[model samples]
Target: MLMFATNDQLLKNAIDDLGKYVDLKDLGEPRYILGIQVNHDKKEQKIKREQKITLNQRKQIDDILKTFHMEDCKAVKTPMDVSQWKQSLARATESKQATNCPDVPYQSLMGHLMYLVQGTRPDIAFATNYRLWW
Candidate 1:
């Protein structure tokens, strides 16, 4: 399946002429393609690509929250504490002995965070990368 967009009537006419010798089905203007929502502003002559959170993404986040028992946690203004995080990192490095921290699903959580990073939550990229080193 081939998809294309053109505003020129000459091109449309050319395509229609070629259609006589080839099989083609025009699906018309597109609103969505490959999971990304497309919005066209004809008046402004601009197009925008929007990534909406899917139901599966919502479920993944909910499941992660439930796994960590943070389903009822309150939303915070800031997502990270830089000073506290630095202090903790310093302590971990200074202590030669390994800490007996409970095994958290860090990899799984990071996988989800990566998807968020690739999607709409790019603000969390730095924090997520920092946590990966821990």
Candidate 2:
């Protein structure tokens, strides 16, 4: 877990207070957590530093794509195939039970996309939302 405060004193106080109820060992600053990267160090200068946090999920995104066998896919403006989607929608209206392709890992892909949107992929929110429809 990560905690934040407006200043060092407040952060320390919060940690100390929490320590009273439970045993706590400060792990210093977090270098990375989950798929997010935390960067605040300067390699050139070792003496002075600034308190700036930079977070990114490039590695996480790559891992997710590779896991879903999409790492080799070419980038496109559309999130999904519009023609196939339309056909699916049309078939849905024709029959009460919409039988989607069993080969497609729709649920798994949606779950991962949801996690990304909730964590670090605001850019894909619209695409994910649109994909949620029948």
Candidate 3:
């Protein structure tokens, strides 16, 4: 669907001109497009677009948590825990078994987190990118 913002007269004229070349159906003002919510204020002559996760994105995160058995995990106040990272790094360097650790779905979870970071969660991008390095 095509959506354009303009004055009433101009929109009518454009629609009339385009109707000659192609069929057109007015779906009226759009409240949502793609994954973004659209808010229009006619009195202020302003429009705002907000990015929000759809039902599919919610299900994706839910599935990821379920796969890892982390559905009931407690939420942390911060995205990155520096103390935990330090302990993990220390353990990795001291233990030979760290080199032979089993494979994990880190790449898949990173991909999902990256999508969230690129969309509406810029706050987690730094932590996500830091994890990518290791």
- Judging by lDDT against the true structure, name the best candidate: 2
32-82 per-residue lDDT for model 2 (tens digits): 788777776565334544365677777878987998888899875645577
**Pairs that clash in candidate 3:** none
Model 1: pairs clashing at backbone N, Cα or C within 3 Å: none
Clashes of each: 0, 0, 0
Give the CA lDDT, 0 to 100, for residue 107 in model 3.
Answer: 73
CA deviation > 4 Å runs, candidate 2: 41-49, 77-100
Model 3: residues >4 Å from true position, as ranges?
1-57, 79-88, 95-99
Point to the candidate with the largest TM-score: 2
C-alpha lDDT of candidate 3 relative to the true structure: 0.66
How many pairs of residues in model 2 come into backbone collision?
A: 0
- Please provide TM-scores, in order, for all candidate models, with all chains considered together: 0.48, 0.69, 0.53
Better of 1 and 3 by lDDT: 3
Cα RMSD (angstroms) for every candidate in the order listed: 6.9, 4.7, 6.0
> Residue 108 in model 3: shift from native, Å?
1.4
